[model samples]
Target: MDTQYTALARRFRPQTFSEVVGQERIAQTLRNAILENRVAHAYLFTGARGVGKTSMARIFAKALNCPNTKDGVPCNECEICRGISAGNDVDVSEIDGASNRGIDDIRSLRANVNVRSMRSKYKVYIIDEVHMLTKEAFNALLKTLEEPPPLVKFVFCTTEPNKVPDTILSRCQRFDFGTISTDNIEIRLSQLAEAEGFTVDQEALELVARRAAGSMRDSQSLFDQLLAFGAQHITAADVHRLLGTAPDQRLIDLIEAMIDRRRDAALSQFQVALNDGVQLEAFTDQLLNYFRDLMVAACGAEGVQLLSVGRDCLPKLQEQSRRWGLENVVAALQIFADTKGRMQRVTYGRALAELALVRLSLLADMERLDDLLSQLKAGNAVVASGTARPTSAPPPRLAASTSPVPAPSLPAQKKNERLTPPPAEVASGADSPVTGSRDPAPIEAAAPPPVIAFQPGLEAELHRLMLSRLTDMTGTHLAKVVSTAISGPNRLDFSFSASYDIGRKACERPEVQARLESLVKELTGQDVRIQFRTVVTEAPEAKPQPAQPTNSRRKVVESPEDPLVQEVAKTFGIERWLRQEVLAEVVEAPAGGDLPEE
Candidate 1:
């Protein structure tokens, strides 16, 4: 006969509150409840999966019903205790809420609620995943739950407590179980491995514990699967292979490439990971978690305890964190997070992964605007993260022309030169005689305009600087400017077509003018006024034509003396202008010199 093999998870189930791992608080509370005889009629336990909610429920049930209970702990030797541990106890029932979640099931359970216990002080009813019960079923259990028989006690367990109705929740004592720490889970695995006589590396156990993500059952189950490898000794390489996870070194190399902004190197490392059979989704997820750790490291000494990695990797992580500033780390996290979601929706996830890698690599050179602003506000030079610019460096100036446009060949103004303006009264018109023969009031002296050593491209450079400073409407308006020139020593003029009246007006805005003036000061180191003017070119006037002759409109009569009549007679081969009256005289005279008809 062959022996049946029991899985580690089932073989190692906790039978007593003291044996339950990673839930000491709940266990102690339950023990106090039992010791004080204050156990509630209905109790609710909630937590993430594999965090001992169900185990705590069963242990509590055993403690309540065990005949040989000691200090709220059940003696595993007794028949009733063994029966409860084996899940065959008559007085203590363990129900699967998922399987029997309808009103009929609740009805049947309710019908049995009043029956006396067969052999225990209290009949404990434990329902796992109580949130799975339907609305009607919950309603059916409410009355019984709120007012249960003195001998009946109910324990409700669920991972999703939010799904449980408030009415049901309000009637029970609720205890929330937290996830087991990685160290605790690792320790448990080590103990299991030693008991099973299988040698396992410490790192391997850590890998399994971390992979469990705070679930004790998951860790045990994973360890069991690893044991099936049939090897007497387990290693980290084997765990990595089984989980399809990239080695930490590989992940570090890949991150280093990204930190250095070496896209090709990062892509190559990613390909290597793929070649090593690492799933793209898993790889992206791991990268995101790595950045999360980097964020923790960036927080400095206070976060060292919060790191998931061991001390061996701490120094490296801190170095990487320094290289990738907090801002860049956050940006990388966002990029990878988005890529992770996209990879799930597409068949070709490798492309998204590669694109994310490229984006992360490019992030090395990028600086957050807010960071720069803060630095500037602090009186520090706004340098990029990886750059070596000095803290006290001045703002980069635009390169000036090597040979500035030569100053006009005029006598250089003396340092104390002053220009006097003529009196307004005399300046209006010298022809106007003074009404009172009083000498014109002494002219008020005015400061001479500062002369600038102009550059040929000064206007162009100022325009460029202004364009860089302005945005949106102002920038658009500045773009339509046809030309820029220095109309006066202290006045910069911008010319536009007359058709662009609106644009010129936009440029005349006070803010726009102020920005232009500031740019001028920045470029020439002198105060300059800005002026906007429109240019219109008029078309040439048409010349007047010579006056027409006065007699040109006269009408002409047909006569023999007319040249036109002679030309017509000669062309037709007949006498010129042969009159009808002449023919009548010639014919009538022959016939008695009288006309035949009037």
Candidate 2:
């Protein structure tokens, strides 16, 4: 039977330190340590999975125990090296800490450390997932690690260093591995494809690299999947379809729609993605990453180096950067990030995705810092230079200014009286028919009687207004008390909820009540009743507008001239007068020129 097709990852697992991809610094450091014969008794390698932790550990073991070591590297020809590579070396033990985490296993290991190597100079122990060891097991191994025999060495590998005890960590020399860049991952994948006699497009390799998300193992696994699916050559479309990723073009289109504030287009693209069965959470994550790239591009950073996207895509990112400043991109990223958490709880993930896209589109119009500053400066210049004023003639005066008159005594009325103002003509104090002298009119006599149009339960509007104003004044602390009921046509009974003790006390205070009553009387010309009760009235329903309400034919009201407009007018006058008198100004020719010399 034909052997099952081995994955490219396992097929091309690095045999020697030099063969490893994208971990030169780590490889060089370990090599130097070996060459100098200053190897530590215990070694701890930590990083994300698949960046060559396990592979490097094995290679280090081989280098340590090789028979023909000239500089502290394994000679592949050596019998010891071959046995270790084949997992048959008696002196080189590879233990899985996850399965054998009991104290007894560690005690067994401690017992074996004293045995001399039969075939090699040193006996090396490689413990994978070292963090899985129990506390007792860790303590059991600590004594041996602190003072191991000269012939024995320990290599502990873990993805999480924080889970390991500090004591164990203190006994080991640690090496941190960093994620490989997409460029490097792609280069390595291409080499594998070439060596395997399979044609792979560069874009396809890039897709594999990006899907890897900085893990060489993941990248290799993806490469193997793609090869298995296609059996030979692979294209970008195949990779996108297989990975359930949005096409590059579609992603660009979606980004462009967001930049243009075209919500409809964005929704349409999202629908297409939904129809294609793209994972909502994954799509959002990808878009966020894309926006991050745009942000980096906008900041003039080395975006290509930081991003897993293609080099050709850099231009698109740069163009998007020009349209969306860093702040807008950052805000979009935050909105999407927040949406991701919400999406997990939502059953309608597509709806959440669409909402996020629409929100981002709306936020695209937000003013960037530079643009806002520019606008503010322009406005300040207009204010400072006094240039944003109309040059039209001022309105005609309404007669001449009149002398002030004393206000008349207010009339006593029921609390239900309406607060409407009297007609302008009647209130203007027009000339009396018989009196020749201009005498001041009495305020009470000139004012019309107030009308009371009662809406049975509309008193809550007043209470809401009061509460809002109170909240504004007291910084959100005192507004909780106000409740209301229609006491009569013009009176609203105010009360406080049980929870608002401070508001109740304030309302009961004579001084506070008097001030509130005075403000109410001044504004509405009616005495409002203040009371404390637990009852609440239903809020009024909002009324719908008429389909075709009568349009008002009333004359337009004109606003009074503002100070800025007046100041601008005054400045212009000086300039105008100077221009008319000092500068050249043509006077009307003396009535149609004089008759030719008589």
Candidate 3:
């Protein structure tokens, strides 16, 4: 007889509290509860899927019901422990809330709560996906859940605790199971591999662990899939091939090409990756992950612990991060992220990816505005490197000045003119002397900007300023004003249309009134009062309709003499009096009322 094969996830399931990986704190809490004889009536285990919520629940149940339990850990050799482990125990029941999630199911459960346990010391109920229960069902189970029998305990598991009611959450002790870290998951995978006699590469194992995304069961499942590759030795190449991702070296080469502004080389590398069966979405995902590491590396030694790449690749990654500066690295991440989004929404992923690559290549000379400003302040001319694209004209020089005279335009100035103001212009009392130069006149404080007098278009100017400063909603509210008039020397009245009731109410808010008052004071040289009024336009009177004669009524479409009615009645063997009575009923019914059917 052939033996049945079990999956790695199932074969290596955690049996004891100590065996449960990545959740030591939770396991310890449950064990302490059992040891101290202070187990609560209800427990709420919440977390992402496959993080051992169900496994923890079962372990807790076994610990509570096992006859030979020691130090809060169940001895799996006993009959009751074995039954619970196999999930067929009579005393402990595992219920899937998704299937049995109605009021009737809760009623049945409530009815059986008072009964004595079949064999174990306690009757434990483990409900998975408890958030799927209906509102009525949850309400029905509330009282029983809040105050169950002393011998009965309830353990509720959910992936989304937000969907669960706050009432239910308050009645139980909640334990949140966080995702296993990459290191912990990798260690667990190595243990499993050693037990299974598999010679897996450390890099391969790390790749699988990282690919799991902080789920132990997910990593174990992925490891099982790799075992089917029919080889005793598993390499990093196998992991990349299985995951449909480009190799680390290939991705590194592509990034280097982009950093060097070699557009053709980058495109060639991208094409090669695609041709090697690297999926577009996967390729884009790998690029995002690599660039994320680059961003961390740009943070210097403090972020070295956060890197996901192998030690062999860390030095190269740090070098690349330096070459592609932090600003450019961030820009590249945004580009790939947008490309990934487009790939998810459309089928033309290759085109979007190629466009993103070209855009990244152009960012080789990208610099932050602050850096450029610092360079200019230090009297250094900002020059583009050879890798930067050529322009028809050189960039204009920028210099700060407080003089009334404006800087000359490029056409009016010579090819190599200094950016400093001329000595003739500086000698005027209006201009300040240049930096580090001996001045003939003492430096004076710069004069304030001249304020213009109130003009006819003052309201228009205020409205423009409001539009620039306020949000779209507030600006729209202000725009709904029908007209603005000068009610007094220092007061402006804004009239709203009758239809702009909401807008008028919005403008009447205290904050909006204060903002308008400040704008008015700023525009005019004095405190100005702003008033908002609504124009109550009278609605036009509705016209009276001409009366119709009482004799004119809706005629009945069906009659006893109608051919179709007669046919239907005769076909059903209807009597003459029955047909007459039906017609009378139809005719006597109000025009708006529905007719009766036989």
Per-residue lDDT tens digits for candidate 2, residues 1-598, read 8988877777788888887777888888889999998888889999999999989988998898886766657787888888888778999999999999999999999888899998788899999999999999999998898889998989999999999999999999999989988888989999988997899888898888888888999998888888878857889878877777887778889989988988899899888896896766667778878877887888888635634367788888888888777778888878887888888887987778788888888763345333334433332111222233222332222222233223335466454443333222222333331232224243232222222222344344344334333433332433554545566655556565555556666566787767666555534456666555544546679899779853364222222244443453364453343322322221221335432221
Best by lDDT: 3
Tens-place lDDT digits, model 1, residues 291-374: 888888888864444334555787899899987888888888888888888888889888888888898887733554444444
Selected candidate, larger lDDT, 1 vs 3: 3
| lDDT for each candidate structure | 0.77, 0.71, 0.78
Give candidate 3 misplaced runs (Cα > 4 Å).
301-308, 365-598
- As a TM-score, model 1 comes out at 0.65
Choose 2 or 3, whichever is better by lDDT. Answer: 3
With candidate 1 superimposed using the best TM-score fit, by how many Å does residue 226's alpha carbon deviate from the native? Answer: 0.4
Residue 559 C-alpha lDDT in model 2: 24
| All candidates: TM-score | 0.65, 0.64, 0.65
Clashes of each: 0, 1, 0
Better of 1 and 2 by TM-score: 1
lDDT of 3 by residue, 380-427 (tens): 322333121222332232222323234234344354433331111111
Show model 2 residue runs off by greater than 4 Å: 303-308, 365-598
Span of ten consecutive residues with least summed lDDT in model 3: 421-430
Clashing pairs in 1: none
